[model samples]
Target: MYYIVMNMNCEDCGRYIPHSVYKYIGFCEEQGKVVFNEPPTNCDTVSKTTMDSLSSVFGSLGWVYCIDCKAPIFEMEEAVKHIASHHLITTRFMYDSVAAEEVGAVS
Candidate 1:
Protein backbone atom coordinates (compact mmCIF):
# COMPACT_ATOMS: atom_id res chain seq x y z
CA MET A 1 0.00 0.00 0.00
CA TYR A 2 3.05 2.25 0.02
CA TYR A 3 3.43 4.79 -2.83
CA ILE A 4 5.89 7.37 -4.05
CA VAL A 5 4.50 10.83 -3.57
CA MET A 6 5.30 13.15 -6.44
CA ASN A 7 6.52 16.75 -6.23
CA MET A 8 4.87 18.75 -8.99
CA ASN A 9 1.67 20.39 -10.14
CA CYS A 10 -1.02 18.24 -11.77
CA GLU A 11 -4.73 18.06 -12.42
CA ASP A 12 -6.66 16.98 -9.37
CA CYS A 13 -8.38 13.63 -9.69
CA GLY A 14 -6.05 13.26 -12.69
CA ARG A 15 -7.86 10.28 -14.14
CA TYR A 16 -5.20 7.58 -14.90
CA ILE A 17 -1.74 9.02 -15.41
CA PRO A 18 0.15 5.92 -14.27
CA HIS A 19 2.98 7.17 -12.08
CA SER A 20 5.31 4.75 -13.82
CA VAL A 21 4.76 6.66 -17.08
CA TYR A 22 6.55 9.74 -15.88
CA LYS A 23 9.92 8.53 -14.69
CA TYR A 24 11.63 11.89 -14.64
CA ILE A 25 10.84 15.50 -15.60
CA GLY A 26 7.50 16.35 -14.02
CA PHE A 27 4.71 17.65 -16.23
CA CYS A 28 3.37 21.14 -15.80
CA GLU A 29 -0.22 21.26 -17.03
CA GLU A 30 0.16 25.01 -17.48
CA GLN A 31 3.18 24.70 -19.74
CA GLY A 32 1.75 21.73 -21.65
CA LYS A 33 5.17 20.13 -22.16
CA VAL A 34 7.76 18.23 -20.15
CA VAL A 35 10.18 20.57 -18.43
CA PHE A 36 12.96 20.17 -15.90
CA ASN A 37 13.87 21.91 -12.62
CA GLU A 38 10.55 23.64 -12.08
CA PRO A 39 10.37 24.57 -8.46
CA PRO A 40 8.27 21.85 -6.88
CA THR A 41 5.05 23.39 -5.66
CA ASN A 42 1.89 22.02 -4.07
CA CYS A 43 2.08 18.45 -5.42
CA ASP A 44 -1.48 17.80 -4.31
CA THR A 45 -2.46 17.25 -7.93
CA VAL A 46 0.38 14.86 -8.89
CA SER A 47 -0.39 11.30 -9.92
CA LYS A 48 0.95 10.24 -6.49
CA THR A 49 2.73 7.27 -8.01
CA THR A 50 5.89 5.86 -6.43
CA MET A 51 9.29 6.78 -5.01
CA ASP A 52 11.99 9.36 -5.28
CA SER A 53 15.72 8.37 -5.52
CA LEU A 54 15.81 5.53 -3.07
CA SER A 55 12.62 3.97 -4.38
CA SER A 56 14.58 2.27 -7.12
CA VAL A 57 16.83 0.71 -4.53
CA PHE A 58 13.89 -0.46 -2.42
CA GLY A 59 11.72 -1.33 -5.46
CA SER A 60 8.45 0.25 -4.30
CA LEU A 61 8.62 2.53 -7.30
CA GLY A 62 5.63 1.76 -9.45
CA TRP A 63 2.05 2.73 -8.77
CA VAL A 64 -0.91 4.74 -10.13
CA TYR A 65 -3.79 6.51 -8.48
CA CYS A 66 -7.41 5.60 -9.15
CA ILE A 67 -9.72 8.60 -9.03
CA ASP A 68 -12.94 6.73 -8.34
CA CYS A 69 -11.45 4.41 -5.76
CA LYS A 70 -9.11 7.11 -4.43
CA ALA A 71 -6.24 4.68 -3.92
CA PRO A 72 -2.90 3.68 -5.39
CA ILE A 73 -2.60 0.64 -7.64
CA PHE A 74 0.75 -1.11 -8.05
CA GLU A 75 0.17 -2.96 -11.29
CA MET A 76 -0.93 -1.65 -14.70
CA GLU A 77 -2.95 -4.74 -15.60
CA GLU A 78 -4.91 -4.48 -12.39
CA ALA A 79 -5.46 -0.79 -12.98
CA VAL A 80 -6.77 -1.42 -16.47
CA LYS A 81 -9.19 -4.03 -15.20
CA HIS A 82 -10.33 -1.74 -12.43
CA ILE A 83 -11.01 1.19 -14.75
CA ALA A 84 -12.67 -0.93 -17.39
CA SER A 85 -14.99 -2.71 -15.01
CA HIS A 86 -15.68 0.14 -12.60
CA HIS A 87 -15.57 3.34 -14.64
CA LEU A 88 -15.82 2.78 -18.40
CA ILE A 89 -19.18 1.00 -18.23
CA THR A 90 -20.72 3.97 -16.48
CA THR A 91 -19.09 6.35 -18.91
CA ARG A 92 -20.30 4.34 -21.87
CA PHE A 93 -23.83 4.33 -20.56
CA MET A 94 -23.78 8.08 -20.05
CA TYR A 95 -22.35 8.61 -23.51
CA ASP A 96 -24.99 6.38 -25.02
CA SER A 97 -27.72 8.43 -23.39
CA VAL A 98 -26.21 11.65 -24.65
CA ALA A 99 -25.80 10.14 -28.08
CA ALA A 100 -29.46 9.18 -28.09
CA GLU A 101 -30.38 12.73 -27.29
CA GLU A 102 -28.19 13.98 -30.12
CA VAL A 103 -29.76 11.52 -32.55
CA GLY A 104 -33.22 12.55 -31.48
CA ALA A 105 -32.36 16.19 -32.04
CA VAL A 106 -30.93 15.44 -35.46
CA SER A 107 -33.96 13.43 -36.49
Candidate 2:
Protein backbone atom coordinates (compact mmCIF):
# COMPACT_ATOMS: atom_id res chain seq x y z
CA MET A 1 0.00 0.00 0.00
CA TYR A 2 1.15 3.50 -0.80
CA TYR A 3 0.74 6.12 1.90
CA ILE A 4 0.70 9.87 1.51
CA VAL A 5 2.23 11.34 4.66
CA MET A 6 1.45 14.95 5.42
CA ASN A 7 0.65 17.58 8.07
CA MET A 8 3.55 16.52 10.30
CA ASN A 9 6.89 17.96 11.39
CA CYS A 10 10.15 16.15 11.96
CA GLU A 11 11.34 15.66 15.52
CA ASP A 12 14.98 16.03 14.53
CA CYS A 13 15.04 19.24 12.43
CA GLY A 14 12.43 22.00 12.50
CA ARG A 15 11.75 21.83 8.75
CA TYR A 16 8.32 21.72 7.15
CA ILE A 17 8.11 18.36 5.43
CA PRO A 18 4.67 18.02 3.93
CA HIS A 19 3.06 15.52 1.55
CA SER A 20 5.98 13.19 2.06
CA VAL A 21 4.89 9.68 1.26
CA TYR A 22 5.96 6.04 1.33
CA LYS A 23 5.02 2.83 -0.46
CA TYR A 24 4.80 -0.16 1.82
CA ILE A 25 6.34 -3.00 -0.18
CA GLY A 26 6.09 -5.57 2.57
CA PHE A 27 3.87 -6.36 5.50
CA CYS A 28 4.93 -5.54 9.00
CA GLU A 29 3.94 -6.80 12.40
CA GLU A 30 3.00 -3.24 13.29
CA GLN A 31 1.52 -0.46 11.13
CA GLY A 32 -1.63 -1.92 9.73
CA LYS A 33 -3.67 -0.41 6.90
CA VAL A 34 -2.97 3.10 8.19
CA VAL A 35 0.19 3.94 9.99
CA PHE A 36 0.64 6.46 12.80
CA ASN A 37 0.19 10.22 12.35
CA GLU A 38 3.70 11.09 11.23
CA PRO A 39 5.70 11.72 8.11
CA PRO A 40 7.41 8.71 6.64
CA THR A 41 11.05 8.34 7.60
CA ASN A 42 12.01 8.29 3.92
CA CYS A 43 10.28 11.60 3.28
CA ASP A 44 12.27 14.77 2.82
CA THR A 45 13.05 16.78 5.96
CA VAL A 46 11.67 20.32 5.77
CA SER A 47 9.68 22.89 7.68
CA LYS A 48 5.99 22.41 8.37
CA THR A 49 5.10 25.67 6.61
CA THR A 50 7.15 24.89 3.53
CA MET A 51 5.59 21.48 3.38
CA ASP A 52 2.14 23.04 3.41
CA SER A 53 2.95 25.29 0.47
CA LEU A 54 4.55 22.46 -1.45
CA SER A 55 1.55 20.28 -0.83
CA SER A 56 -0.62 23.03 -2.24
CA VAL A 57 1.47 23.56 -5.36
CA PHE A 58 2.71 20.06 -6.18
CA GLY A 59 -0.49 18.29 -5.13
CA SER A 60 1.47 15.34 -3.77
CA LEU A 61 3.66 13.94 -6.52
CA GLY A 62 7.20 13.63 -5.20
CA TRP A 63 9.48 15.12 -2.58
CA VAL A 64 12.42 17.52 -2.45
CA TYR A 65 14.68 19.41 -0.06
CA CYS A 66 15.53 22.96 0.81
CA ILE A 67 18.46 23.98 -1.37
CA ASP A 68 20.05 26.01 1.38
CA CYS A 69 19.48 23.73 4.35
CA LYS A 70 19.38 20.32 2.64
CA ALA A 71 16.26 19.52 4.61
CA PRO A 72 13.79 17.29 2.86
CA ILE A 73 10.81 19.33 1.75
CA PHE A 74 7.72 17.57 0.49
CA GLU A 75 5.16 18.85 -2.01
CA MET A 76 7.75 20.98 -3.71
CA GLU A 77 7.36 22.04 -7.32
CA GLU A 78 8.03 19.25 -9.75
CA ALA A 79 10.23 21.11 -12.22
CA VAL A 80 13.12 22.83 -10.50
CA LYS A 81 14.32 24.45 -13.70
CA HIS A 82 14.40 27.87 -12.12
CA ILE A 83 16.54 26.65 -9.30
CA ALA A 84 18.85 24.90 -11.70
CA SER A 85 19.15 27.96 -13.87
CA HIS A 86 20.05 30.09 -10.90
CA HIS A 87 22.61 27.55 -9.75
CA LEU A 88 24.23 27.45 -13.18
CA ILE A 89 24.40 31.22 -13.39
CA THR A 90 25.93 31.45 -9.94
CA THR A 91 28.53 28.83 -10.75
CA ARG A 92 29.55 30.57 -13.95
CA PHE A 93 29.86 33.85 -12.14
CA MET A 94 32.05 32.29 -9.52
CA TYR A 95 34.28 30.73 -12.14
CA ASP A 96 34.64 34.06 -13.93
CA SER A 97 35.52 35.81 -10.68
CA VAL A 98 38.18 33.22 -9.91
CA ALA A 99 39.69 33.58 -13.36
CA ALA A 100 39.78 37.35 -13.03
CA GLU A 101 41.49 37.04 -9.66
CA GLU A 102 44.13 34.73 -11.14
CA VAL A 103 44.81 37.15 -13.99
CA GLY A 104 45.14 40.05 -11.56
CA ALA A 105 47.55 38.07 -9.41
CA VAL A 106 49.82 37.48 -12.41
CA SER A 107 49.76 41.16 -13.36
Candidate 3:
Protein backbone atom coordinates (compact mmCIF):
# COMPACT_ATOMS: atom_id res chain seq x y z
CA MET A 1 0.00 0.00 0.00
CA TYR A 2 1.13 3.51 -0.77
CA TYR A 3 0.49 6.54 1.47
CA ILE A 4 0.72 10.27 0.73
CA VAL A 5 2.50 12.68 2.99
CA MET A 6 1.55 16.41 3.09
CA ASN A 7 4.07 18.92 4.38
CA MET A 8 1.74 21.92 4.28
CA ASN A 9 -0.28 23.57 7.04
CA CYS A 10 -4.05 23.56 7.11
CA GLU A 11 -5.49 26.68 5.47
CA ASP A 12 -8.54 27.07 7.73
CA CYS A 13 -6.69 26.22 10.93
CA GLY A 14 -3.03 26.70 11.60
CA ARG A 15 -1.73 23.27 12.68
CA TYR A 16 0.70 20.64 11.55
CA ILE A 17 -0.93 17.76 9.70
CA PRO A 18 0.44 14.31 10.41
CA HIS A 19 1.66 12.13 7.56
CA SER A 20 -1.00 9.50 8.27
CA VAL A 21 -4.03 11.51 7.07
CA TYR A 22 -2.28 13.05 4.08
CA LYS A 23 -4.10 11.89 0.94
CA TYR A 24 -2.45 13.56 -2.06
CA ILE A 25 -0.92 16.92 -2.95
CA GLY A 26 -0.24 18.53 -6.27
CA PHE A 27 1.05 21.71 -7.89
CA CYS A 28 0.22 23.15 -11.30
CA GLU A 29 1.70 26.05 -13.24
CA GLU A 30 0.22 27.42 -16.45
CA GLN A 31 1.67 30.36 -18.30
CA GLY A 32 2.24 32.91 -15.54
CA LYS A 33 -0.28 31.26 -13.18
CA VAL A 34 0.61 28.87 -10.38
CA VAL A 35 -1.81 26.77 -8.41
CA PHE A 36 -1.12 24.53 -5.42
CA ASN A 37 -3.71 22.42 -3.66
CA GLU A 38 -3.51 19.87 -0.87
CA PRO A 39 -6.70 18.01 -0.10
CA PRO A 40 -7.38 17.67 3.60
CA THR A 41 -7.57 14.47 5.69
CA ASN A 42 -11.15 14.74 7.01
CA CYS A 43 -13.96 15.43 4.53
CA ASP A 44 -17.55 14.33 4.03
CA THR A 45 -18.37 11.08 2.22
CA VAL A 46 -21.33 10.27 -0.02
CA SER A 47 -22.83 7.48 -2.12
CA LYS A 48 -21.39 6.54 -5.54
CA THR A 49 -24.31 7.93 -7.45
CA THR A 50 -24.05 11.17 -5.59
CA MET A 51 -20.44 11.50 -6.68
CA ASP A 52 -21.35 11.24 -10.34
CA SER A 53 -24.12 13.75 -9.97
CA LEU A 54 -21.81 16.16 -8.26
CA SER A 55 -18.62 15.41 -10.15
CA SER A 56 -19.03 18.52 -12.27
CA VAL A 57 -19.37 20.59 -9.15
CA PHE A 58 -16.36 19.20 -7.26
CA GLY A 59 -13.99 19.50 -10.23
CA SER A 60 -10.63 18.38 -8.71
CA LEU A 61 -10.64 19.03 -4.94
CA GLY A 62 -11.28 15.89 -2.90
CA TRP A 63 -11.85 16.35 0.85
CA VAL A 64 -11.74 19.17 3.38
CA TYR A 65 -10.62 19.28 7.04
CA CYS A 66 -9.50 21.43 9.91
CA ILE A 67 -5.83 21.17 10.72
CA ASP A 68 -6.07 22.47 14.28
CA CYS A 69 -8.99 20.49 15.70
CA LYS A 70 -8.89 17.66 13.16
CA ALA A 71 -12.55 18.26 12.45
CA PRO A 72 -14.40 16.86 9.44
CA ILE A 73 -15.18 19.35 6.67
CA PHE A 74 -17.79 18.86 3.97
CA GLU A 75 -17.67 19.22 0.19
CA MET A 76 -21.24 18.86 -1.09
CA GLU A 77 -20.02 18.15 -4.62
CA GLU A 78 -18.06 14.92 -4.19
CA ALA A 79 -19.89 12.75 -1.69
CA VAL A 80 -20.74 9.65 -3.75
CA LYS A 81 -18.45 6.61 -3.62
CA HIS A 82 -15.95 8.68 -1.76
CA ILE A 83 -17.97 8.47 1.43
CA ALA A 84 -18.24 4.68 1.29
CA SER A 85 -14.51 4.17 1.45
CA HIS A 86 -13.50 1.91 4.35
CA HIS A 87 -10.80 4.25 5.55
CA LEU A 88 -13.34 7.05 6.13
CA ILE A 89 -16.50 5.25 7.28
CA THR A 90 -14.63 2.90 9.58
CA THR A 91 -12.81 5.76 11.17
CA ARG A 92 -16.09 7.56 11.85
CA PHE A 93 -17.87 4.45 13.14
CA MET A 94 -15.03 3.61 15.51
CA TYR A 95 -14.43 7.11 16.82
CA ASP A 96 -17.58 9.17 16.34
CA SER A 97 -21.19 8.07 16.11
CA VAL A 98 -22.29 11.50 14.92
CA ALA A 99 -21.25 10.55 11.42
CA ALA A 100 -23.91 7.85 11.27
CA GLU A 101 -26.63 10.33 12.09
CA GLU A 102 -26.95 11.20 8.41
CA VAL A 103 -27.19 7.61 7.19
CA GLY A 104 -30.75 6.87 8.35
CA ALA A 105 -33.79 7.43 6.18
CA VAL A 106 -36.05 10.11 7.48
CA SER A 107 -39.84 9.87 7.78
Per-residue accuracy of model 2 over 1-107 as CA lDDT, tens digit each: 21132443232122321122221121122333232324546555332333345444456545544333334444234224423332100100001224445455553
**Candidate 3 lDDT, 15-58, residue by residue in tens:** 22222123222112111222223333442221122334334334
Best by lDDT: 1
TM-score of each: 0.26, 0.17, 0.17
* Clash counts for all predictions: 2, 7, 8
lDDT of 2 at 74: 48
Candidate 3 lDDT: 0.29
Candidate 1 similarity to native, TM-score? 0.26
Worst 10 residues of 3 by lDDT: 86-95
Task: Show the colliding residue pairs in model 1.
Answer: 4-50, 4-51
lDDT of 1 at 58: 29
Q: How high is the CA lDDT of each candidate model?
A: 0.37, 0.31, 0.29
lDDT of 1 by residue, 1-107 (tens): 33423433332213222222232233345445544434446343443333242234224546545445645667656655654443210110001224445455553
Error of 1 at 96 (Å): 34
